[model samples]
Target: MCKQSGTPLQDDLFLEETPTSSVTEKVAKPGPAVELKGSVFTLPVLRLKRSDLGAIEEALSERISQSKKFFENAPVVLDLEHLETPAEVLDFAALCSLLRTLQLVPVGVRQGSAEQQLAAVEAGLAVLRGGSVQETVAAESKDKKTGEVVKQVVVPSKALVIDQPVRSGQQIYAQGGDLIVLAPVNAGAEVIADGNIHIYAPLRGRALAGVLGDASARIIVQSMEAELVSIAGHYQIFEERLPDELFGKSAQVYLQEMALTLVPLR
Candidate 1:
């Protein structure tokens, strides 16, 4: 009743298929983990000539008037490089006063002679080129050493402070220790800290913490809802819209388990 199909060959000639798991195992594996890095903020330098104090003030005032929105709370570095004249001719205090009027904080002086450096130091402003001074001091100490005794020189860490509110378009930076802000940071403002950023008032602007690659650094703000928050180069932008509940609230931002988290401050 059944049409005889072709004679069935009994000898086996079939080859088994290779397992897919073996192919997957032969593929390259992932490389080592990567460490995230942070960013640092440097103030803009404003240079002036030795005999151009009046012009310096005028130019600075004009700049402030034109970009007042931009330099509201920005810190500035006064470059006295062109002011190579005698220290007696320079009115450091008056210059500082002028800067204060423009809402620019002059933290340090750069490119000055030894006498200028001395005056700056006496005026409570840190000397920018203190590295050479420190190195020379260290070398002298080594030369004075006679026996196997080595002098241990410890340079105490200095703290920088900002006692004013940070407005929009302004920026504040701390080089070493913690950065303490006693005022509110408005939108568009930027605050950077090498160690930690502690904002005593509301912070609606950008705040960067753990600058200089400090993963352990943290940002503490009285009020959150920041335009942008960054830590160790990782950043988050609230462009579309910030949560309504987060507005006008105290919060803390930090890196936890390689992720950025914003938590309400208790």
Candidate 2:
């Protein structure tokens, strides 16, 4: 037998007793299809000290030769603010092509001149924030009495706290903030921060603080067995076993006159 329209089924109660609006109200709504939020990641930055393409290519090749697997296919951001005003405009497309041919992905650029910015966009690269030179954006405001326009820059602060172990191949980055780890950072892991990194357990992999050139940033480890440590782009790699006294001991890493320095915490 068929039920008539507007009639409830034998096993249903809401459709018979509840009004349409009330029945609909009792049903759950569908969740949103997407969400938006802020996030950060640590990435390699290539600070351009010169505009010569030949030199840049040669240097990149040499650097990658020393650590091919480490840099292979990794996304690198070009820092253009450090580049001097060139006699000629940079060829961003060609440069990006070169990077691709060398197995490196050129994804974005930062701190570029207006011309460079346009060129980079044309070359399919994004303009990312947090460049070593893109630390601030100036907002112009007129002084009330003087009627003079003034530029103001503001910086935000934050901190990332992790309560569990950082396993191998895991990367933790605290962009524009500090990173605090309550557990061990195992081999092949990396921890980076723009401000500072505090590890309450052993650091067996890499710890790079002041990643965006904050020279005063530091790394404090409860037990240091790091394969590599860096501060403000200055780095040290332990090719051999660490000295017995320094291994498995508390230590702090910082920059001294632009050089990476590590010392005992006690």
- Choose the strongest candidate by TM-score: 2
Q: Residues 237-264, candidate 2: write the lDDT tens digits.
A: 7756788877999999988887778898
Point out where model 2 deviates above 4 Å.
Answer: 1-37, 86-88, 132-161, 169-177, 233-245, 264-266
Q: How do the residues 1-266 of candidate 1 rate in per-residue lDDT, one tens digit apiece? A: 84444444554433445545644456788886897886445445666665566787788787677646657877776666666564544667888887887788888887777787777777778776521112212222343556554666544246567888888878888766678888888888898876678888888788887655566678888777687787765566665456766667777888998698888877
On lDDT, the candidate that comes out on top is 2
Q: How much is 165 displaced in model 2, in angstroms?
A: 2.0
The Cα local distance difference test for each model comes to: 0.70, 0.82
CA-RMSD of model 1: 24.9
lDDT: worst 10-residue window of model 1 = 131-140
Given candidate 2, what's the lDDT at residue 3?
61
